[model samples]
Target: MKAISYARYGGPEVLALGEVRDPKVGPDSVLVKVRAAAVNPVDWKAREGHLDGLFESAFPVVPGWDVSGVVVQPGVAVSEFDVGDEVIGYVREDFLSRGTFAEYVAAPLRTLARKPGNLSYEEAAGLPLVGLTAYQVLSKVLQVKRGETVLVHAAAGGVGSMAVQLAAHLGARVIGTASEHNHDFVRGLGGEPVTYGEGLGERVRGLAPEGVDAVFDTVGGDTLRVSANLVAPEGRLVSIADVDVVTYGGRYYFVRPDPEDLRRLSELAEAGVLRVHVSETFPLHRAADAHRLSQEGRTRGKIVVVVDWDAGAEGGSQGV
Candidate 1:
């Protein structure tokens, strides 16, 4: 299979496209014919060895976690999905040795979920990691409720976009930060857009007037620190940007992917309650370019890599 990988930790230039062997499936895993995959910050972070301690540092690592694919064959013990069901999932973050940036990947049944009927392969591929992260931060970690106000930093980002929609669907007024260009886009997604720059705190204050109930910071640095003061008493502040900071409450780092969380997101998306935004698409071989664009910090939403778009599939082009 044609794939992109790096033999060492470095810049995008280190990535090379070439052929690699297919992955072997374990008894608890399913071998997926990868149709589409999504690139997250973790893809670049892992390529640079930023997560060396959490995940093994193996040379020639294929860097990607989000997958939207079709099940080609299920392991002997697997019963959650059949051989032809379309599925999407967050591949093994527990071990970075294997990844979804290829023609095929073996994913555990626990991380896999049925793709939302309303979403396309490219769209579903973009949902797993970022969607799960947003769901966990807002639903699990923050526990946002109706009639409250929540502030989401980097509101136009991959995770931020989903976070804004999820928070709004849960009945919270969402204040999201993006540049002037994405203001309308954020508004369309049910958020009051605030430009993230100097005087961010003031802008958020002006929007809410009353204090913010929770602050979900996907962009670390001052966004986290300054937003801390804006939180209501006993409010949660979850930061996925991996910044070290002092706060009265909230969790840091992208938490582990949870099955129940993915299930809820699936139902929400299927029911038209949750929305996914996919801003760009690249071929699987261009995984390097996908990483470059993501690291540039300008994409409005998730970036996806299409491994194969088979035209013979049921509804349309099922990429697997």
Candidate 2:
């Protein structure tokens, strides 16, 4: 199978498209023919060895987790899906390797969900990781209530964009932090935009003089520290970016692969409660270029790498 992989930890330059052995399916896993894969910051961070302490690595690692695809074969123990069922997944394992940036992936049943009928493969691919993160944090962790004022950092970015919409859907008044250029985009997502930087605290305070009821921190470090001072006395704070959030009475969260959660997100998309904006897409062979774009950290939404199965067929072969 053709896929993007890296033998050693490094930059985007380390990623290369090449033919590798096909993934093996397990008893509780299904082999999915990948149509699209979404790039998240963690993909590049893992390539740079930044997550070394958290996950065990197997070299020549395929670096992607979010996928929208079709089930090609189901494992012996799996009955939830069969050949040709369209699906989306955050196909993460306990360690690196066997990822979604490939022609196919062996996704565990726990990570798989039906693709939303209203979304394209590219848009569906972009939803799993970011959507799951936002859903878990807002619905379970933060428990944002209606009429509350919620602050979301980086509202134009993937996770932040999803968070902004979900918080608003929960009936919270959302205040999102972004650059001046993205204020309109943030507002489109049902958030009141506030430009981040030196005057961030004051700007948020301007919207809710009593301080916000919850703060969703996607930008850590100084931003996280600043967010602490902007939350109301009984409010909650959660960070997906930095563990240091705990120092300020906040919870640091990590998104997990939950089929139920992914399914709910899909339902929301179908019902028009959530929408995923795909800012750009690259073919599978140009995944490195996609990585470079994501590394810039200024994308308005998600970046995706698509498998050109039609192009492959035109070249006289369909299977990679």
Candidate 3:
């Protein structure tokens, strides 16, 4: 299959577009014909070897985790989906190879969920990782409740935007931090947008004088450190951005594949309560450009890589 891969960890220049062998489908996995794939910061992070000690890495790695497409063939033990069923998956496995950047991914069932009826392939592709991150952090880690106020750092980001919507859908008042340009965008997603940088807590307090019930940090560094002071003593704090969160009595989170969690996001999308914004789309061969854009750390929504819009069952063959 045609795919983007790197022989060694380095810069975007190291990525090469070429044909690669198909991924092996385990008994519980399915081979998917990828219509689109979404780029996340982790893609570039892994490409630069930033996650070397974390994910088991190998050379000639394909770098992507979010895929939206159709199931072409299901493994022997798989019954949740069949041929031609539309699906979205956060296809992160135990290691770093056979990613969603390719034309096909042998995705395990746990990572695959039925695509939301209201979302396109690109939109669905954008949801799995970021959407699941916010869902898991709020629903599982923080346990946000109705009428509570939740603060989301970097609210305009891929994950932060979804976090804002998810928190609001849960009936919590959302306060999101973004640049002035994104204030309306954040508000459109049901968050009260606050400007970032110094005095962030003071600005947030100007809206919620009682202090927020929970803090969700999507941007690390000072934003996270400063937001810590704004959370009430009994409030929960969760972060996917910083390991230092643990030092401040917060839970450091990593998103895991959960069909149930993803299903909830799908339901929310279908119900018009959750939406994914795609900032840009690149052809599969231009994956490096997508990585570069994500590396800039300025994107308001998601960046997607389009494989074959009209992909077919025969095209699903990946040398398996």
Quote each prediction's TM-score: 0.93, 0.97, 0.95
Model 1 reaches what TM-score against the true structure?
Answer: 0.93
lDDT of 3: 0.90
lDDT of each: 0.83, 0.93, 0.90
Residue pairs in collision within model 3: none
Backbone-clash count (model 3): 0
Q: Global CA lDDT of candidate 1, please?
A: 0.83
Clashes of each: 0, 0, 0
What is candidate 1's lDDT per residue for 1-320, written digit by digit as tens? 66677788888878776667778888988999888999898889888889888777666787788998899999989888899998889986566767888888888887888888889999999888888888888887789999989898888989889999999999999999999999999998899999998998888889876679888888887777788888878677878884564454567856566677787888998998877788899876567778999989988988998875464311221111
Q: What is candidate 3's lDDT per residue for 107-210, written digit by digit as tens?
A: 99999899998899999999999999999999989999999999998899999999999999899999999999999999999999999988887898899887
Alpha carbon deviation, residue 5, candidate 1 (Å): 1.3
Q: List pairs with backbone clashes in candidate 1.
A: none
Which residue pairs show collisions in model 2? none
Q: Distance from true position, residue 281, model 3, in Å?
A: 0.2
**Best by the TM-score measure:** 2
lDDT of 2 at 284: 81
